[model samples]
Target chain A: MTGWLGSLRERAARITPGTLLVRGAAFVFAAGALLVAFPGEILLWPGAAVALVACGAAPALAPRTRLTTMVLFLAVGGWIVATTTYAEPVTWARLATLACLLYLVHTTAALAAVVPYDTVVAPAVLVRWLARTAVVLALTVGFAVASVVGVRVVSGQAYLVAAVAGVLLVAALAGLLTLSRRS
Target chain B: MADGSLGGAGDEDGWVPTRAFGRAILVVGVLVLLAALTGRYDLVVLAAPFALGTALSLRRRPAALPAPELSTMDARIVEGDDFAVRVSVANPDPVALDLVLVRLWLPRWVRVRDADHPYAAPVAAGSVAEIDLSGTALRWGRHDVGPLSLHGVACDGLLVSLRVECEPLPIKAYPATDPFRADEAMPRAAGLVGQHHSRKPGEGGELAGVREFSPGDRLRRIDWRVTLRTRRVHVVSTLSDRDAEVVLLLDVLHEAGESGGTGGAASVLDTTVRAAAGIAEHYLHRGDRVAMLEYGFRARRLRPATGRRQYLTVLEWLLDAKPAGGADQPSTGAFGAHLLSANALVIVLTPLLDQRSAAMVAGLARSGRFVVAVDTLPPSLRPPTDGAWGPLADRVWRMSRENVIGLLREHGVPVVGWAGAGSLDHVLRDVTRLASAPKVGRR
Candidate 1:
């Protein structure tokens, strides 16, 4: 694991700015695809578009500008969640779209922090970053799909409690991973 | 000057969190935990990306951090010569390094030619990335090149490794030599064997005269035709070529004007060392014994020696010598009189900035020692002022300098500006002529 991670870090160093832009575009496209997949939240379209653009263009913007954009993006995300809370029942598609948007923000910010504004990123490195983020998103979507199927079969507060338990389980698994990394 | 080796292995082999990493953790932790408490499935989805990223980044640990190695082709060079330095950082683990920034510390004497000083480059995992640092050495001195700082980041800046520091490299640039040469013959010759023709008749290649053969004369010396015509045992007598000692007295008390090194303004000391080197090489090449004496705050000497090897030895001493006294305090006369050989031609190289050095030249002249003071001061130097008093002060300085030279002329010491080859020809010829003329002795 150490050797594998070391190699990946070494490869990351070789990434250029061009590759960064391409990967960032892909992340933004993935977010747009999520918006299209869950068209039930019409109000989220403009907010999602703005957040994606802000995050995608973060590298080119000044640090202060990016900071402001991030703050605004978080506010919009909170509003979207609040507005959709009472509109309809939470479905697997809505959950998947939310997951994709969250991952897109994380990936965009991470890439922006790594490379400067003017640097030309290597293609292979950007692809590697995208591939890793995609794997995580796919896994999260798979969990949501499984939960939705389980809720359909057994509808009640019991299933909701189970869903909460599942969230706790994933959180605990993440904590354990962090602890192992520290050691 | 920092040395090349930075810190121990223990300090360099670890992962450290950057500000970005910390921010990521904070944002992920707060948002996800809030969503879990409220039991909002949509909010939980919103927090999933950060948690996954944090978990994945921390789950796999990288091996030892990259180690940097800095090297250069040549440490010792002449002024105006450019040298190439190679900086290679080695990654032992398979993790690709996304970003690596290296900042090098260079002395003022060196200027980078082709690239920016603080370099940034990318390195693939488990490989070495080399960067070229090309620069020209501007001056002659001992300089240090580095103790470079390296910043490495992996996993798209999510993971930043500990900064690595390297050591400094030492470089020495030697002074350039002028084109001055010395005369083949001296006024007086003391060594038995040399290349210069002497007045005294003896066994040599050049014909001196045809005279009656004297006892102890070699049979080969007898000129048969002269003996037959004069009805006597005449032998071919040739003038013996003897080597003479040339002592270079360098006045290192004061150095005036700016020194720009190669292709630039020459300071008094710059021209002085170059002229000294040229004279030494000229005399040494002609099989004449050469010695050097530097008098400033302290005196240093290289005993009279002959051969090409001793030229390098003399140059080494010249390189190490510096004008000791500051401009405020005039240098005292500290001539190495004990190191002088009898009838040695004393060529004093000085800018004549102080009266003490001028008086020393006068004393050497009065003692009947053949002396020549080569003016090492550049004539094109301007006074350090832009106002009306600038030209006035410069004129006053020049007038005083001329008066000093006139005094040396009165004492029969010829003062000449260094003009490369044949710079000492006329003065040496005058010394030879004076040696033959009759002079009044002390009462």
Candidate 2:
């Protein structure tokens, strides 16, 4: 695992600004495609755009700039989740959120691998942000997936709980992948 | 110069939190609050991984680390010589560092082919890494050894880098003489006026020929008019066999002038040394007690000695001597004092740049030594005929030199102007011929 982390770090060092831009563009295109596949998902558009911009800006900004952008990302993400809490949760909305969350995961992992370890004085702050975002995205996705599975099994309100658990599991997988790549 | 102001204040006193770390905290805190309020588990889950990564990132240290102080054990080393350097690295922090990269900078002249033992390895904390550095001192002058840079990285990826100016080491470069040249100039001991016996007999002490008395001959050497002069000009010519002490006076002053840089070109000093060395060698080989007196900032005298060792010693000293001071007049009294007892020959090798040395040589000639002034001044260093101050200065310098030669000639001293580009043999032959001429009374 350590060797893999070392390799990832080396790869990150070799990544030029051009490559970073290409990767960010690719993520955005992929998100757009997913969104187009589900036209009903209007909420995913903004989330995808924001994620793309954040990823694209990651390479140019120093570590300090990255931290500021991350803060803004968290604030917007919170507002979106809060405003939609009263409305019926849509499948498209959940998927779009998951995409944005995954984008954050990849970007953060790359940053951790690239930044010199000695330069980071406050790792806990960054770690907390990543972990919290991962857990929220996972639980939301789990709730949605479990809902579908529970309906086929029992056709009852118990599906909501299952859906939440499924969403949590997916989010957990994303977090694990991101953290593993970084380590 | 304030004590507290050195290297500025400490990290706490002038700490600026990086923008990245601060934003990371703010973002993560807001996301957590939103997740708790809205109960959006996905957002919460996403934040978890970022938090963990941030924690890991925090473990990394700042890159602005301090440099290590480096000093050498021995500063001076001769060419083709090697010496050890003791490098000490001090980590002021209480915590120990895992990996430290130290690079020592050396002068371009010195060829550091390989350092002793492991050149690159980990260095311990606050301890000295006594690495044996061995390299040939290829050239001379003061060389900068290093501004040694130290890059320290902790196990957790935090790095502290520092660069410190190391103590400088000075190496002197001395000239190496050609052994072949030394062997060719062997000394002997069988010349009149030298420390050896001479075959020539004359009134100067050693028996020469019983010649007819010449008019104006010293009465003391008359031999009671040689039996009523034998009714002919008969005189007893006794040659002095006493060892003659020859002192080679060399001028090492360099003056600003055009040196004839063409075929067979030579600098003023170059011509002087060669002439001095060649004459010294020639006289020494002829069994004369030869010595050298160098007149420069202060007069340096090597007492008369006859042997191969003494010749080599003189050559070594000549090779090491360099020109001193600006275009000031050369000191004559310094050379005159050294030439006080020299009865053989007093050869002055100079570019004849100024009046002081010329006057000194003139004084020596007046003292009755066989003063032979070998002028190494080339025509190129002479000023043009134009009536400008520059030309005037050169003319004055030349006239001063001429006056010295004239003064020496008046005292029956032989002055050889070596303007030819051939061997010292040409100049030596000229001096000998002139020295062999009969001394005429000054009109």
Candidate 3:
């Protein structure tokens, strides 16, 4: 056990400063999602904390592995179970916070997977990468917020219709990209 | 710096979706399904970024592959000198490369510090990114700095370009000569001008015994006291100062032990090359005509010349030195005895590991060429102890090598181990004494 810990410590020592920063950000985002999900529920805090720790550590250890995906699934699934069990009132601010946290986890993990732990990475590379991520997050979340406000101003049935239309539009775009692959 | 055109027509474009794309798509699909089942709009917003980020990143694919080029800045350097290698990668497509991963394949002797780790850099559209690596060239010989490999990621981590390879740049590292100096004069000086004092009768500083004044003797050399005491006209005879020709013969018949570069345990080839460089530098500095010859599978020769230019050429030639001639089929066909000057001092750098090497040394002595053999073998070399009889085999090898040296000494060939400064002093002194002695011809 001691030898294994020493080996783990040695491998961790090789991680470049840039990569360590990305990993540290991923951990903070993952843990923040859990804390927001169970704000007033004290009894469910222990299991939520364990799931949060797993989400943080998974990407740090092996970002490319499927184990990270499984841990993510565990965290998301635990959030859903807690919300269903507790008769809690949902608010837009809380939901938006949860949405942003989940997006941060996915993007950081993707960056970590491609960048090797011991590689020499320029600061501009990480900055440009984060900047692009910010652009995508701002566009998608802003559009969704506008869509929600506009739909609510109309009717209940129209809100459901807008949601279904958005899904169909995304599907059609996916189909177009697959067909254009040969050309 | 190396510069290359990117996106050649012949290159195959390898663009594919990474695992991140699949994971993002999976999370997006699950979140949407949950939104529909729970009748909650919040869940759909949670999935929106994953779906849009993937779509935006994959919207535009790179039309061309990247180009990579490798180059070294240092023109010529001796072993243990610093060198720099620059790897330049160009992104030709309109889509900016998110990250360009570059790696250099370095030779064992040429060390580019921090080249072991790969580099990740971002290149703007139609721009080039360069990685400069600097380190020491630890050992002598020709080495390549590259074959820089480049693979790029674009539009976040969704799209990856095919790996591109560049041709390697070759650099020559010359042998680092050890500090060497020899105070002894050459056995025979051949040229009319040089630092060595020759025994031939001529006008010079060093005086020989006073002799009876002859018809050709100069009046300035007259010993007035001796002439007055003996009632005979006597003149001081001075030896001529002439340049000597030195032929460094490398016996690349066999090699033993491992080379640990400069200031480390040396192999036979390492010892031979470094010692030759040292001896050549010392003599060439003193205005002696120095020449080099290899008695291996191929006879490589550099003509006798006296200058700093010749010293540089000698170092360049030694970079290609390696053990070649086999023990059984030792070839001296290319190295003819006629190539050697009659009065030149031939110093053969040999390990004496093969019987043919010893035979060649004896042959030089037989040909009446003043030859001095410097042993290139490292004394601390030990045989591999794999099994029971390893120690016994090692002992036998050492004993036989000692016997070869003894026989070469008996044959009037002076054999000595290479010890930097004054390495050839005793041997040259002995050879010079023998040259001055009278010859007894057969009746």
Best model number under lDDT: 3
Candidate with better lDDT, 1 vs 2: 1
Q: Per-residue lDDT for B54 in model 2?
A: 48
Q: Which of candidates 2 and 3 reaches a greater TM-score?
A: 3
Alpha carbon deviation, residue A69, candidate 1 (Å): 8.8
lDDT (10s digit) by residue, model 3, range B249-353: 998878789999876789999989989999999999999999999888777889999899999999999988887847434345667677899999999999888
Which is the leading candidate under TM-score?
3
DockQ for model 1? 0.18
For model 2, the stretches where C-alpha displacement exceeds 4 angstroms are A1-183, B1-244, B257-266, B270-288, B308-316, B324-339, B378-422, B433-443
Models 1 onward score TM values of: 0.75, 0.42, 0.86
> Per model, how many backbone clashes are there?
32, 100, 0
Displacement of the residue A132 alpha carbon in candidate 1, Å: 7.0
DockQ of each: 0.18, 0.05, 0.37
**Candidate 2: TM-score, chain B only:** 0.48
Candidate 1, A141-182: lDDT as tens digits: 876776557556666443364547446746665675557456
Q: Supply fnat for every model shown.
A: 0.23, 0.03, 0.37
Residue-level lDDT of model 2, residues B285-396, one tens digit each, is 6556778877677567788887787776676666555576656534555545545563456768876666666666777766655566777776555456676587778768
